[model samples]
Target: MKKNALLDAAEALLSEQGTQALTLTAVADRAGVSKGGLLYHFPTKEALVKGLVARVIEEFDALVAEHEDGAPGSYSRAYVEATFEILTGEARAHRRWSAIMAAATDPELAAPLNEAMTRWHGRAPDEDPDPVTGVIVRLAAEGLWEVLSHTPELYGTARLDALKQRLLALTRG
Candidate 1:
């Protein structure tokens, strides 16, 4: 529980202030725990980062599993569903996601991020679209996510609804 709390605090800080703003003391302070307690769980920032990466992967896997109903090639659909859920869910906005992404500029982080995406983009987890089309669609979706993350209010409800409908139709086709 303490560990999870620390991770949650770290995630919040990462989202709000990026990795450059992240520090062991900040995490400890944000989590409302002692430094010793935080250290007992993570021991180091790198370890905490690895933990965060693992949690993101695990969360992604669970989201896919929950929404895809065990079907193959369900990644796009799962992604759409999960994203909608994220946008609508009661949880805080995922600012940390952008921060963690920035942190991936480090060689160490780059490897894990690449590995995670490669594993997820393989046959079983994602759908088998035409390879070229899939690449295009995925890139486009990522761009859309960045836009949404950075300037969410720029998209009003109707626009978001329309984009969702169009993307869903395209993914289905």
Candidate 2:
């Protein structure tokens, strides 16, 4: 519970105040926990980063799984569904992805981020026979997300929604 609180605080800081505010002290203060308390769960900033990355992976897996049930023989749709879920999910969901992906710039973080994405490439735990379209869906979604996060003026809401709907249809095959 304490650990999760720290992670949530970190995400909030990252989203609200930018990466510079994601210090241990800031996170501790945000969580209403002692600095020592934060350190007990995450010994260092790197450890805290790892926790955040883990949260990202965990959340992504659940998003994918949530869309898996009704997709019949293909998980391709699930990939798009998961993307849409993230894009349209609560602000924290979108912010979490942006924060983790941005944090992945550190050399130490690259492996874990890549590993999580690679695992995603392997498809959900249940094993979806068709995995190719998933990669495409992820690519398109990430591209759209990159724009939406950094340059909202590039795409209007209707256009974004229309594009997502079209992408979903394409991935259906």
Candidate 3:
């Protein structure tokens, strides 16, 4: 519980105030825990950042799992749905922005994200009949995710829904 609270505080700090404002002291205060409590879970800022990244991955994986069905291209479909959800949801959008910014600034921090992507894409080959198409769909979704993250209003809600449906369609084997 304390660990999650510390991580949540760190994420909230990063998302709301950017990396410059993310400090162990601030996180400890935000979480209403002592500095010693924070240190118990994360001895360093790097560890806190890594924990935040891991939590994001875990939440994203859970979202994908929720969308999974026993069918060809299930993973691809789930990936598309999960990507859309993360990009559009208000709280998730902020969390993702923080994670992206953190990863962009530090190569070491990107390792876990890269590993998760590899694991997710690796599953595509086995679950998706036309693996190439699956890869393409995933790429398209990722592209959309990137663009939407920056300019969510680029495509209005209706258009975004249409695009999401189209991506889901591409997952059909």
Sum up the clashes in candidate 3. Answer: 0
lDDT of 2 at 17: 72
TM-score of candidate 2 against the unseen true structure: 0.76
Which residue pairs come into collision in candidate 2?
A: none
Taken over the whole model, the C-alpha lDDT of each candidate is 0.67, 0.71, 0.82
lDDT: which is higher, 2 or 3? Answer: 3
lDDT of 2 by residue, 62-155 (tens): 8777877655434666766776676666642445554565466697765777887776666553343345655677678777766666554576
Give the higher-TM-score candidate: 1 or 3. 3
Off by over 4 Å in 1: 70-73, 91-99, 124-133
Q: Write the per-residue lDDT of candidate 1 for residues 1-173, one digit (tens) a residue.
A: 46667888888787778777678999999999888899998998888887777776676668767877544335676766666666545442363364356457577865676676787566442354545455555556666666766666677778767776676666664
Candidate 1 C-alpha RMSD relative to the actual structure: 3.0
TM-score of each candidate structure, all chains considered together: 0.79, 0.76, 0.81
What are the per-residue Cα lDDT tens digits for candidate 3 across 47-93? 88888888778988999999999799998999999988887675545
**Candidate 1 overall Cα lDDT vs. reference?**
0.67
* Top-lDDT candidate index: 3
Candidates 1 and 2, the one with greater lDDT: 2
